[model samples]
Target: MTELDRLASDFGNAETAIALTGAGISAPSGIPTFRGDDGVWKRFDEGQFTYGRFRSDPAGFWADRLELHREMFGGEFEPNAAHDALAALARDGHLDAILTQNTDGLHRDAAFVGDDSPADGITDAADATILELHGNARRVRCTDCGNRTEAEPIFDRAADGERPPTCDCGGVYKPDVVLFGEQLPGAVIQRARSLARESDVFLAIGSSLAVEPAASLPRLAASSGATVGIVNLESTPCDGVADVVCREDVTEVLPRLRDLAASG
Candidate 1:
């Protein structure tokens, strides 16, 4: 049997299955990976993205943030086939949840969480079964008061020269995403670890598996006796340890995997 056939059989037999995705999964949807050749890193200084930097120069931080907001959310980007496949698997009970490292908000869009209206030609996954390792860029949070709200309005304010928008409590509003050098949310990390430990099959999709803490999930699942699968265009650190490795386009592979899992 083929590798995909084996994956399908294993998926069919799995009692619990989970997927971990990264920027590569969203790249097909026109979201640029931050570390790629033409990525955001080229234009923006990485040192300025830290929480410390934001604290030191709030106005400057917001100045950069406004530019980033325009770059990331200014265009109409949508989830691709890979997102739909994962959503389909979840809808069909073949997958449990998706754990993602992307801050792009494409997964939520694919899952249809925010709107009564859908994007043109995009189908909503039946449920929003996704866990974000990095926080969503589409949402904003008050650094002091902890109030969370949609990011669009805040972006508009930023565009209108409200560099750093103030919350009702007069606290600074920042994107909900975890900044560089900031600790990942404790509860989110714990839940992700718990899911990895409990999974019967762990699919690592599009991630290079280089980032710490979140990158350790695949190893955690493998150590716990789960079948580990890695799917990426390039080699990942975990490829040697993965039971199944498919170096192919995520958009193509995910749909095939979904079909096989459903058929099996």
Candidate 2:
């Protein structure tokens, strides 16, 4: 059988199948991946995104954040074929959950959660099964009050010369992303690890599998006897160990996977 056919068969038979995505999945939607020649990381100072720097200079943090917004989140970006295919898989019950490292919020925007989901008929509590390893960029949270809100208004204010927006509770509002030097949320990590352990099929897409802890999930699934598949434009360290490796653009491969899943 072809690699895609094998993946389709495994997915069709698996009790629990999950996908892990990174910035590469969103690249087709016009989002730049980190470390690319024209990536946001190259445009800004690395230290500016660290939690320590933000704590020391809140105003400066917002200033840099404004630039970041312009570079990354300012444009109109929509979910590409890759995201739509995954959503379809989830809706059809061929996929159980999506564990993503992307902060872009495209997965959520693709209507991963809603009353319109086909999975709602399968289970009463059916909701978008998403585990965001990194927090969403479209949201802002008060550091002290824990109030979360849409990030556009704050970005607008910042663009209008508001150095740093403040919350009604007098707390500083920061983008709800896991910045450098900040620990990933413990609860989210635990959930991801649990999913990895329980998954019968794991698909790692558009990620280099370079980031720590998050990268380990695929390995965990593999070790637990899950069929591990990876799809990326570039080679990853796990390619040698992955049960299936497809070095193709996610936008192209995922739709085919979705089609194969639908055929069966």
Model 1 over residues 149-213: C-alpha lDDT tens digits?
A: 87899989988899788899999998888888788877678878998999999999999899976
Q: What local distance difference test score does each model get?
A: 0.83, 0.83
- Alpha-carbon TM-score of each model against the true structure: 0.93, 0.94
Residue range with the least summed lDDT across 10 consecutive positions in model 1: 115-124
Query: Which runs of model 2 end up more than 4 angstroms from their true locations?
Result: 112-128
lDDT of 2: 0.83
- In candidate 1, the residue pairs with backbone N, CA or C atoms under 3 Å apart (3 or more residues apart, or in different chains) clash, namely none
Please list the residue runs of candidate 1 whose C-alpha ends up more than 4 Å from where it truly belongs after superposition: 115-128
Error of model 1, residue 81, in angstroms = 0.3
Query: Model 1: how far is 166 from its true place, Å?
Result: 0.7
**Mind sharing the TM-score for model 1?**
0.93
* Candidate 2 residue pairs that clash: none
Query: What lDDT is reached at residue 219 by model 2?
Result: 89
The sequence of per-residue lDDT tens digits that candidate 2 reaches over residues 171-247 is 98888888899988777788789888999999999998999766798889999999999999889988876899999
